[model samples]
Target: MLPEFPMSRQCPYHPPAGYEELRKEGPLAQVRLYDGRTAWAVTGYDETRRLLVDPRLSSDRSRPDFPVLVPRMAAAKLVALVGMDPPEHDVQRRMLIPSFTVKRVNSLRPAIRRIVVERIEALTADGRRAADLVPEFALPVPSTVICELLGVPYGDHEFFEEQTRRMLMATSTAQEAAAASAALIRYFEELIETKLGEPGEGLLDELITERLGRGELTREEVASIAMFLLVAGHETTANMIGLSILTLLEHPGRLARLRSDEGLAAGAVEELLRFLSVADELQRVAAADIEIGGRLIREGDAVYLPNAAANRSPEAFPDPDVLDLERGTRHHLAFGYGVHQCIGQNLARAELEIALYELAVRLPELSLAEPVSQLGTKPGGSVQGILRLPVRW
Candidate 1:
């Protein structure tokens, strides 16, 4: 019998133990999902990179054969870039590329640094002995940056954040997820109209004044893009920030090195990203028949790429399980690969570098307020993140 896909990890920082057996079996192997459907699980580094960039595969969630890693993920209609294929995906991605370029993202470093410092001050503002890093620090840095970048009112963050959480949680009922999705759609629709009339100096305004006005994109498309940006902008990076901090805390030697040497900051971020492939899986559907790993995948077949498995494959990096700050990790799939690769990666990289550096410098004596095993994580979610990171300095 084939091992099941989407296996739960015994430990939060690693992939499920079954992945080792699967990897040893072959690059691609058949596995059953919770829905009782059989799909191909891509586990090897070479196969994963190939399949991610393969044009024969479609990211379209609307496709009948699209792999639904979790039932809740399939409940919503395909509206974001993750669910769109070429031509459509190409057009939408092009419009938003300028704002996320390395130069543009670097320009916000000063502001991101300020946000990090401010959040740290706020975390200790009341002279509290301990604080939850998730909400207080991780969540706020990216949330504030994305809000300021898109001109979204930071005041409305709580509502949208909660709604987004519900939508992504695998345990959420279809009805609940759908309702949250509807609320976000409604919110963005209204916001788009407001930006249309009196444009602000943000990505949303640029989309309105440039893309929509030039007929390059429709109003609904702009709204969908905005919704995508708002959710993707903060959630993934926040989770990563929390996870990175926890990982560093677990390795005091590395943490001490980071504090002592500023040059290691960038490489450390990449290494942490590699060490923890936060997203459990990347789903795709074969748009046409294709042969991979000496096996033929028919058109309309589902494929699931377990990033955690691929990232940890010894074939890609020796001693894959170990986290080395000096490791050559530029090839990590934490941000993904191919045309669907994360567009906001530049922004994320900047946030991680600055956030980690500030924490090292300002809170040199920071330590977990509670035992590591006592911490909670979001179960049954695509993005793996700490639920709460209690810490004290």
Candidate 2:
């Protein structure tokens, strides 16, 4: 029998066990999803990379045959840039490039550094035995940064974060997901309207003053993009921050080595991304018939490109399961590859580098407060991470 799609991970730090068998099956294998639909699971590194950039594959979720990873995705309208192709995708992506440029992201380094420091200070300030790192540090740094960047009040984070959680949770019901989506859309609409005349210092304000104000894009488009930024910017990094710390804590000698040599922060960040690959899979649909490794994927066939499977492939990385900070090769699909690669990766990298380095320096004695088996794992989500990470110095 084919393995169930979105197979559960045996452990938080490991890929789903079924992925190992799928990789051995060949570059491509079939999988059955909860909806009783079968999709082609691309398990090989080379094939997954090739198909990610293939024009014959479509990211458009509107297609009736498009693979829906979660209920929220299935309920979503094909309105966001993620669901666009070619000219439309290119145009929308270009508008947001200015905010995500290497220079622009690098310029925020000091702010990110400050954010990390402040979070660490707060975490260590309270005279308590231990604290949940997820709430204490991980969730706040990115949430505050993105909020300040987008001109959204940090006070509203609870409303949006809860909604985003509902929308992304794999177990979310259709009604719950739809309501969350509706709430976010409504919030963005009101926020965008407020920014029209009196622009703020955030990205949304810039979009309003420069693009929307000049009629370059519709109000709906600007709001949609802002909503996308809110969810994508904070949630992924927040999860990574919490989970990466847990992974590092599991390897104490490595953690000590990193603390001793601060220069390893960048390499460690990349290594963590390659090893964990929080965004486990990239979903697509074959736009046209394409032959891959002796298997022909028919048009409209759903394709599941799991990054965890490829990142852990022996063909791609020797001792793939081991996390080596000095692993010379940094080519991993953590943020994905091709034209659709993550736009905020530079920013995410900066945050991780700063957070991990300073955490080690500030709390060198940091250890897991809870047993490894006791750590709470968020069971079903496109992004795999811990719900709460308890730690002590």
The lDDT of each candidate is 0.85, 0.85
Instruction: Give each prediction's root-mean-square deviation over alpha carbons.
Output: 1.4, 1.3
Q: In model 1, what is the error at residue 179, expressed in angstroms?
A: 0.9
Alpha-carbon shift of residue 64 in model 2 (angstroms): 2.3
- Candidate 2 residue lDDT tens string, 1-393: 777888877678888888988877899999887778889998899998999999999987667777787666776442566777777889989988899888998999999899889888887776755789998899889998899888998999989889888888877887888888888989989988777756789899988888987999888888888888889899899989988999999988888889999899999999899888888778888889999977999998888899989999889999999999989677888888888898889889988999999998988788998887787676644678987798877
lDDT of 1 by residue, 174-265 (tens): 78878888888899889888877777888888888888899988888888888889998988898899999998999999999999998999
Error of 2 at 154 (Å): 0.9
What TM-score does each of the candidates earn?
0.97, 0.97
